[model samples]
Target: MVQKETFGEVIRKLREESGLPLRKVAAHLDIDPSTLGKIERNERTANKEMIEKFAEIFSTNSKTLLVSYLSDKVAYEIMDEDCTKDILKVAEEKIKYYKKVKKLIVMPTKTKIKPYKEIDSDVLTLAEEEAYQLRIGENPDDIDLDVIDKINVWDKSVKVEENGYYWKGEPYITKGKLPANDKPLVVELFCGCGGTSLGFELAGFEIAIGCDIHQPSINTFKTNHPNVSTVLGDVRKVNPKSFLQLLDGRQVDVLIGGVPCQGFSLNNRKRHENE
Candidate 1:
């Protein structure tokens, strides 16, 4: 089973279930049979190329294997540490911040996104005191923390199974009685957990509906935007007339969303520069 299985265990299960022996996949990975066996037995790690090769040989989604491997790596790093969850929370924020900056900004300016842990205190102090006077007017507070709306495009967002708390964004804690402003009717496609939509709502927009192909995401979205309509399936097959009917004669303000970018998503696929 994929659930709760270590990376090694998952790979082993996949191979065994498919009735493929150890040497078959190992040959595909171009590694020795013993090494691949070690990988299956959790005695060794698999490289990115090996992970990619596994997907090819097994005819499986590369993302599934990649996700398992990355998560396993994280687990190993934090296995014996106290407050591992706390470390993960901070790491999540950092991942979002770094990814956001890399994808949308910094590329054109030749700006390098360095981790705060690497920066000297003196440099940070100077940045706090004098960065604003040089060009853009902003203090430590402005730069240290970010706008909620901007940060909402995180790699990970709120995930709740049932009657759970809203871990982030508006409708926080519970989807209590929401007073709406007469703003534009917002509908998001592939909206996961309603993070960005919630930002829009907080900025006074009325969220009308959210649709995604993921069941868990729809579950989360329904929890947050309790009043909003949600569709869960291939939106391509959905009848436009029926989709509009959900709007109930109200005009939509804007439609926005992008499909998953393989390398920079929750799966967070990593590869060698040469690969």
Candidate 2:
């Protein structure tokens, strides 16, 4: 008998065939690697949004990929629905049935990597634990919104002064400031998804400008901080002089970036020939 590969097994096989590592794939989708691993192992089923992301990243047709692992009845039914929501509904139902039937077993190779739940007791309540397991590095979609609202309400009630998104009673956001009140007007550089800009605002700095290469990150920053000016392009291509021009002749508080570390690493042995 040919051993039936589970949905996760099919996904993992596809991921490997594409020559992409889990970490790279996760980063492309803004997901945690372990969470992706869990999906590949079928420890948890991915939601509609994540499933769509996987489809895009893996370059696989979502309906075709899904049908490969589903029964004929389910496969045909899903082919009819086609939309992500319907596909996810079918996947979830299949996952639920798989769980109840105990027909699915964690593959031995996958078991060696520990589950995410094993390491998170420090920050999660029982409910948050469930939520965390369902979606790593994001608010769990499976969780009831009302329950999450209650938790957020309770968390905010205790720390009313803190201004940021809270996750499981801890701040998912951080704010920072430069020492001394004499620091110059701030312009954020390579400001990823507005984290640094938001931090500057929280620290009482007037964010006059921000810049980033990624369009999505720039758009997100614009959405959150409409008052701040942002230029979207390669930091190197945008002359430092032009960046200062955005400041309208004001001094900069900070500039930050990892200058293509791979470039430095490639020259490491060449430059250190004496060693």
The sequence of per-residue lDDT tens digits that candidate 1 reaches over residues 1-275 is 54588889989988998899988878778789899889889999888767777887788999999899999999999989999999999999988865653443222123533322222445334533343234323233445444643543333344323223222322211122323555788878878889989998898888877777666787888888888887776666566776566776778888877554543553332321121
Relative to the true structure, candidate 1 has a C-alpha RMSD (angstroms) of: 22.3
Per-residue error for 46 in candidate 2, Å, reads 27
| lDDT string, candidate 2, 95-204, tens digits | 78555433222222332333333444764456545544454433334547677445432222352332123112311122122244454466776665777767777887
lDDT, candidates in the order shown = 0.68, 0.59
Pick the TM-score winner: 1
List RMSD in Å for every model shown.
Answer: 22.3, 22.4
Clashes of 1: 0
